[model samples]
Target: MTNGPLTLMQQTSALRQAIRNQEHTGPTSGLATGAMQGNVVILPKEYADEFLMFCHLNPVPCPLIGVSAVGDYRMPMLGEDIDMRTDIPEYYVYRNGEEAERCYDISSLWQDDMVAFVLGCSFSFENALSQVGLTPRNIEEDVNVSMFESSIPTKPAGRFYGNTVVTMRPYTPKDAIRAIQVTTRFPKAHGAPLHFGDPSSIGINDLAIPDFGDPVSVKEGEVPVFWACGVTPQLAIKNAKLPICITHAPGKMLVTDLLDADLAVF
Candidate 1:
């Protein structure tokens, strides 16, 4: 491997190691380029079945990627060396539906009955967008992608339910069309823009203020394109009010050894 910047073809084990060592702890967008990045949710085994069903019913916002065995931090399906407790850039520990704390590692809290779920992330499709010259605004500005709670509701499963959350990317109409085509090939990665143009249509009142992550400029000629985000699970976490729930902080993700191309359909 080259001793320079990571690329779309790069393996992500080293990046995972860096995150594990606390060398990097910020939004994971644009890093570990070719690997599939995943949004994480770790909860008690009791909630695992329902959450799995939730993913099945609401695939766009919660595409099932990998699931760790009960209490096992090692996600062999995603990576041989991945440790779910430390691979993500950051984590949110929620207590009874409220965010109690944010931390870099969750080893201290990982329980014997905890089960981790990995969901497909839009970050996995970004390189394809860039390849087609339709780079997302957040990538251009180097900020965590702006995510907002949308009016669109997800299909409920057991006790898990909530509105879908979406990440925005500003693009000209022509670019958006191309972006949709590129993203559609990666169905696991939230597949294509959900809505574009008016934010009000999706119940997002202001483009300047977002519920999670930093905002980027939506250029005058560019319209905002929305895509289902894995962060949607956070809303479900809030609604379920489980004794404990852990998730990747918005925008940060688990960079896995799975290849982005492996997620593409054609």
Candidate 2:
């Protein structure tokens, strides 16, 4: 609580505890540096099968890292003590496929038949990019990475389907190429840029107004780089019009015990 220097694991654990206690409710990006972060999607058992198939068909934006067993809130595969209902800084509750409310934890809303799916997040690759001296502007500004819904549609699976959502980072063309190379190592972390250069090409007309999360400034000489984002699933969840669904708030990811290197291909 005092901002005293804490070790990486300690910081992550403290953040999770604060979240569970409802003392901290904000974006998790650029925090617990080096630890792998995840985007969470929780839904009832009835919707689990179709959602799983949706993730399978859209691997780029939904590379699953861990899944809680039906009726279980713990994800032992992702961390030693990850609690699906309370670990994330913030949660979004969707009713009839629309965001109904945001809360610190989902413990009160969790049901016995609910399942939680953890998806690899671009925040993991952002850490790798930072290590190589290519830190994203959003991190430098201490803001959430800009995310937008795009024209590129995801492959439909059962009742789940929607266009992809993407996160943007501005970098010089030279740095953008290196970022692509560095990010390519973490496939689970949405490896590599989906596109670079003009935002209009991806159906993002106004860089200043992101469909999700805060917008970071794109410097004059820098081009906006786009990466397939885990938030893409929420759009699908919305399209499905499920009775209820819960997801990590935009940019607020679940910090895990696994190191970012554990997800790197090389």
Candidate 3:
């Protein structure tokens, strides 16, 4: 399932094809370096409009990247030959707001009334951080980025509503300020952090336990910086209690052909 080391572009294209063929089945956090990765959420047509509005209302935590027509699996807008049903490395299927199964592909569950939405992910900003000499701790640790449920509330749309989920990356106050500026350029990618310093301020009781992803070391003098996370939609979707829903497993993102630089505002 693993290919020999590949160039960034080659790796990304191969990764997508591998996922499609069920070869590389794991999280996509550091894969496809410099590419625009996405958080995936697929819902029935009955809930698509409301979810779309919710994303529009809260663009920071749920920046919209690609939206598919009802029942359509191909997301031509995001990448050439992209198939939403098979492109993601892993997917979580939920029923009645509860996880039902984890699968490599969802083609069998495809419905004529389903629509897929791809929201921008924080991984898009990691490239900029690296270019500026600030590598994310998750990359250094070779693990998923730490994430937590924040007290920050999002605007509700229909039955969809919940507190925001944030991803954490520890940095000294000095490095954190620079990380903020680097991330701000990619508004579509969950732009700049929502908070930093204390985890308790965000309703998180334990730094070791993350609602999603994996925990990394917090070196001395480093503080945990929190950024709006795409996982916010999963919590909102759960609250919505939709009959059925599908999303990318944590750390497993939708790798697209879009370049990271293309997302910068200036």
Query: Number of the top candidate by lDDT?
Result: 3
Alpha-carbon shift of residue 63 in model 3 (angstroms): 0.4
lDDT of 1 by residue, 1-266 (tens): 58896664444777788899999898777776778899899999999999999999999899899998998989998888888988888999999999999999999999999999999988778888888777777888878889899999999998899999999988888888888889999889999778999999989999899988889997778899999988898899899999999999877889888888998997
**Candidates sorted by TM-score, best first:** 3, 2, 1
Worst 10 contiguous positions by lDDT, candidate 1: 5-14
Which tens-of-lDDT digit does each residue in 1-266 have in candidate 3? Answer: 44676766777788899989989888777677888999999999999999999999999999999999888998998887899998998999999999999999899999999999999988889878988999999888988889899899999999999999999999999999999999999999988999999889889888899988788999999999999999999999999999999999888889998888888887
lDDT of 2 at 63: 95
Of 1 and 3, which scores higher on TM-score? 3
TM-score of each: 0.93, 0.94, 0.94
Which candidate achieves the best TM-score against the true structure? 3
TM-score of 3: 0.94
- Rate residue 78 of model 3 by lDDT: 87
Each candidate's number of clashing pairs is 0, 0, 0
